[model samples]
Target: MNFNQFKEKYQKFEVEEFPNKVTYSPLVSVLVQTYNHENYIRECLDSILYQKTDFDFEILLGEDYSTDTTREICKDYAEKNPENIRLFLHHPDNKIIINGVSTGNFNAFYNFYKAQGKYIAFCEGDDRWRDPFKLQKHINSFKTNFRLVMNYHSYITVDHNSNLFQTYQMKLQPIGNISGTQLLEGKFHPLLSTTCFKKVFNEIPLEMTQVMNVDTFLISLLGNFGDAIYLKNIFPSAYRIHKGGMWSLKEKKQKYLSKILTFTKLEEFYLSQGNKRLSQFYRDKKANTFKMAAVFYFLNLNFFQFIQNVWNYIKTKFFNLKFL
Candidate 1:
């Protein structure tokens, strides 16, 4: 289905939109997906609002019925900065559930549908951009190179107290352009907060709703359109690791399970699309991830789990070998 068809199918589950006062078309749409992020939402909004750009942009804030004051805070920001922020109040019933788990896919997908800019940038409610010129820098790269579909920069990992813990760059030396296959092979992993991409596709694949990490799926999907540029000069964004963080707060076992599931679904998705190479690649990755999980269990001295994961790894490896 095309984007218009996708909107037609899912638009009825629409969130309440608070219109912004921006008259001209925005060059970029900043997608901010928030849920129970009252503590960090202000800093996240402020970071985007503080960006110094010659061109206009709009913030597509998807507040997914937070039990905390996140929704109220987002409302206040929308009312105050009517020209820059368009707030969408989402319903809990509209959330996408996979394997009995509710996900932010619905909120994120709705924001993508409503995005009206040439480019869409992502910064979750818990993450903040460190550079005021981030948008300007990304837009400049996009304008200069039409073949570039995505761009990302380095980022700093912050603890719950917002103190910097570690800084991450994609590589030791910058590569000008990275292909889609390279992205899928785990050559570079772009954090959602530090990434921006061209608005190329109207319809998202149905398999996307089944995954745990939408950001990873999205980066790989966009790479199919064009090359991704890595910016070395820009100041890194901040990715907060808090108790409330979705991925950060998960247990090691849970994180490994999520990755295993993600890889399995991605493999299936590529197979359905008739991309045998990518399907086989993900199959190999899935088996390797299982091996890693087994190693983790062994080192943690969880003998039962270690044995189970090792058995799973053996099964997956043998399955792949049969296919080969």
Candidate 2:
């Protein structure tokens, strides 16, 4: 669909007309999702609270009932910055557990319903926004490029284990547009902390709620509507790599399997949406995932698992595997 068609489809959500003098609503809504991030949540909140934007914005945080003092810390900040920070929507200490898996994203979904901004930005509890003018920059970029539905920048990676740090960007080239195909195939994605997107869609898709990489799914879904922007070298946020981090903490085998499953779901989604090109890319991604997982198992001397993967690979290669 063209830009006009996209606007007609998704941008029909009732919103206050943009005032010529900039006085209607907060230009953005900052979303912070936390779970046992007691050590780092304060920094995340501070980064947003101290941002030097002229426009008003709300800090919408959801603490998934940390076993530690994460919720209490957020409470303190809410009390201190009542005007800017909305009351934290938190889960109980005993979070929802379905079939032994944690299902505590209710607060995240809740934030979407409660958000009242033209644009929404994301920063996990463990990540911090480094640039105070991040929001301002994004707002300006959107103003200049009305075709862009999403704008994101590179980020800094802090490795707690190695005590090393470095800036990360998708490509060595200068800032440019990110294709919907790339986002759909899981080829590249902007870090959640560094992303800001227009609130064009009416509601989250049911398929999206079932994915592990919520941020990736969202950007790809948005990509379906319009193009996205990427800032090459500019660092707007810091993504900490720690032992307890969500996806980073998972075992290599588990992580690979998760990616395999996610890609399968994504492929199915794209096919259902009549996106054959992206769906084919997802098939390739899933095949590569299986190959990588097989290699890992072989390296670990897990012969049985390795053989199982080999058969799966052969099935996918020659005989159309129906793993899903």
Candidate 3:
């Protein structure tokens, strides 16, 4: 369809047949947002299709107009498995305007907002669950808990040739007890795809979506209501690490600087947004974020590293450097 036609469709999507029929389904909604993930979409969808949950669930594939054949494959899958898959396919015109730059995150929100299930889970096109019980585990937690958010750890940050570089896990001890103060002080969110929780955001500010860290706003809202559970299971959906991935940008020096400055400013904003003081946990969390930003700043900067070495030598000469 043409761009204008898609725009008209999106404007009316809320009152369409799917919206009206959503309340009839009594189960979780798995929201999958796709751009051009032709290579990985099958494996991703296969994982979801095999979920061992007793309850019913639907897959909402929010597709952006992909330049590749990804949309065709999704269409084929939906047509073949009409019961399990429902495509809220985006028309080309439904593009999001981010600082006038339209990208896939626009479609992410569109699909996310049109969710009809009582609970929601996220799975990006490039990622897939490693375990069959991924959905069932989260669904059980959600059925028993009234908390606004729940997430599990995923295997990310792999080595060359696609192997685990390091096993990663977040501090999940205080799972069901996270407070806004804890979040402000630095309780963090796990991977987006690894999370599944109740639909808690009813009044998200429009501006929050435009910022690069929309997930932060989402988790913040959840943390505001109740504690988010951390499933601690290491074998969650795999977040592929490749050249096309966000963290794999070749312009590390420039990207690092920009992200660091943005996050530092965000940290400050988080502290002051509601006239709030961060909890000790969150304070340490923000501090760690800053430290990561500092390391990332000089990660690929030869000159910056040289200058830093020189500075360290000078400080050592004066016996002024302290590792406190």
Local accuracy of candidate 3 as per-residue lDDT tens digits, 248-312:
43455344333333343444455555534432223334344445544554564655654654454
Question: Which regions in candidate 2 have their CA more than 4 angstroms from the true location?
Answer: 1-24, 92-104, 159-175, 232-235, 243-250
Model 3, 288: alpha-carbon shift in Å? 11
284 Cα displacement, candidate 2 (Å): 2.5
Query: Number of backbone collisions per candidate, in order?
Result: 0, 0, 4
Model 2 TM-score is 0.80
Number of the candidate with higher lDDT, 1 or 2: 1
Which ten contiguous residues of candidate 1 have the minimum total lDDT? Answer: 166-175
lDDT of 2 by residue, 1-324 (tens): 333433344332332211122223677888887888888888889988888887888877777667889878988887777667765545353333322356544556556656778999988888888888888888888888888888888765665442446433323322567875555544567666777888987576655555565666776778765667876544546777753433332367666765666677677788888988787777777787778778988987889888888877776656666783
In terms of lDDT, the poorest run of 10 residues in model 3 is 14-23
* Candidate 1 deviant stretches above 4 angstroms: 1-14, 167-177, 243-250, 300-304, 320-324
Per-model TM-score versus the true fold:
0.86, 0.80, 0.68
